[model samples]
Target: MNISWEEIELYLRHTFVTARESKKNVKRVIVKLEDDGFYGLGEAAPSPRYSESVETVKNFLNEFNKLISENMSLYTTLQMLNNLNGNYSAKSAVDIALYDLHTKKLNLPLWQYFGLTSDKIINTSFTIGIDTTENIERKLDEAHEFKVLKIKLGCEDDIKIIQTIRRYTDKPLRIDVNEGWKNLNKAIELIKYLEDNNIELIEQPLPSEMLYENNRLREQTTIPIFADENCKTFEDLILVKDYFDGINIKLSKCGGIFNAYLMIQVARYLNLKIMLGCMIESSIGISAAAQLASMVDYIDLDGNLLINNDPYTGVICKEGELKLINEPGIGVMKIEK
Candidate 1:
């Protein structure tokens, strides 16, 4: 096997805002692996929240290339990734590409490779990033095709943001605080206030390190509290199950499909709801994540949908439902940008 990668910037349709920061564009690295007339592709959309950047992803890929052998098997590659210290997002690219290439060799789609039926796939939630009341309305209008909306909260006027959204549409709402709410009492109060507003769930309301505070908040709220930043690997699931009602598993954060598949099995055994989420990515990343959609309880693979300049075509979202192509591997095809 051989590996090569390049960095590209993805522009958002609107300025993407979360509790932590705002961005109009995000940088990502596209990795390609080829062997004897077969080719596979992957993406690394590293998040600053996880201490990863384009430079870090590229550095890891360079080291991985030196370590990977041409005749390495898929399982061997995965084991090598497992032994790697950190850089889960960087490992994810190799994992995704290996899966894509291997599954294609087997002439199987990734979902079929997992023994999952296509009908088991569910609708993915479209995200509405934090903005002014006016911009929020505009964002809602743009997201009209999606049946469910995930709103970004954590500002001073958290309740007001929901209220503002409510005034425009009655669509089912899910809120992600992105670890913005710090005060346990205030978080409890906010969840209590949102109980009647048709909220489906709340994500990472408190800080990531505040496990006890999150557990306390969960004990007091009717809405399911999901762990995002706090839950990364299979081990975190065991710990977070005691605090959170669910976990948001990201392929990049968890080191891609191999790791995420293991995490899903453990999450189900722990009786924790699974929400497959994504960073701001292109179709390659989104499609790779969508392959596991049938196994998760909820889907948030709208990272590709939020982007205006996606260089590849893979899984597509139609009215909130991710439509996976019947083609082999992760079903991604690069197009002229």
Candidate 2:
């Protein structure tokens, strides 16, 4: 088997907003593994907020590919990859692509190979980035097709934003702070203020810049706090075990389906609420995560499908429910190299 990698530029149909920032573009690293003339692909979009550059991730992948291609088995490959820090998304993409090939070689559906057989579909929350109260309300009114609404709210004047959104609908709602809240005291205040109105949960309300403080903050909120940035890999799981009520796993963050599978088992044992999230990639990445969502507790894998301008295929987000294409080996059309 041989592995090859490429940096992909996926254009977002529109600017995506979060509490900490907004983006009007797309960038990704797609890892492709070829063996016996068959190919498997996985993608990850590197974010500057995570202090990652495309080249940094690519160079590391090059080394990983080089080392693994020298005749290392998957287990050995995993050990080498785990020894590195950061680059979780890059590693995840490569891991996913490898699994894609492995499953395809066996002529099996990925879910089956992973020992999952449920036809359970997950209702994903459509995310509305940090926007004006009026715009958020407008989007909320238009979001009749979704069952849940997840708004990004880690900034100044967050109270007004949550208050405005509450006035619009009483539906189940969640918020991703994106490490925007500066302190635990502030995050606690924000969660308490929004709890009764429409807040179902708060994610990463405290900043991840400080592990001790972030963990300390999670203890103060009654509404469950999910660790996103702080819980990138299972190894980091121990650091956040006491601080977070749950952990959000993004295929991009965990380095692919294989490692993500491992994380789920460990998280379940540790009693962590599992959430599956996504980056601004195409349907390919979303489908990979969707396959795992049915086995987890929360699903936030709608970022790609929710864009008004996604011109790819694989998964569908309708009626707030995530539906996979139901094809084998990720059910994706290969990106033309």
By TM-score, who's the top model here? Answer: 1
Task: Give the TM-scores of the predictions, in the order they appear.
Answer: 0.98, 0.90
Q: What is the lDDT of residue 215 in candidate 2?
A: 61
lDDT of 2: 0.76
Deviating ranges (above 4 Å) for candidate 2: 68-80, 83-85, 209-220, 306-311, 334-337
lDDT per residue, candidate 1, 1-337, as tens digits? 8899999999999998999999999999999989878889999989888899999999999899899888999999899888998898999998999999999888899999999877764788999988999999998888888998999999898988999998998988989999999898998898999999998889999898899888888888789889999998777887888998899999999999999999999899999999999999999999999999888889999998888889999997777788889999999998975
Q: Ten consecutive residues with minimal summed lDDT in candidate 2?
A: 303-312
Superposition error at 118 for model 1 (Å): 1.5
Q: What TM-score, to 2 decimals, does candidate 1 have? A: 0.98
Shift in Å, residue 48, candidate 1: 1.3
Candidate 1 weakest lDDT stretch, 10 residues: 116-125
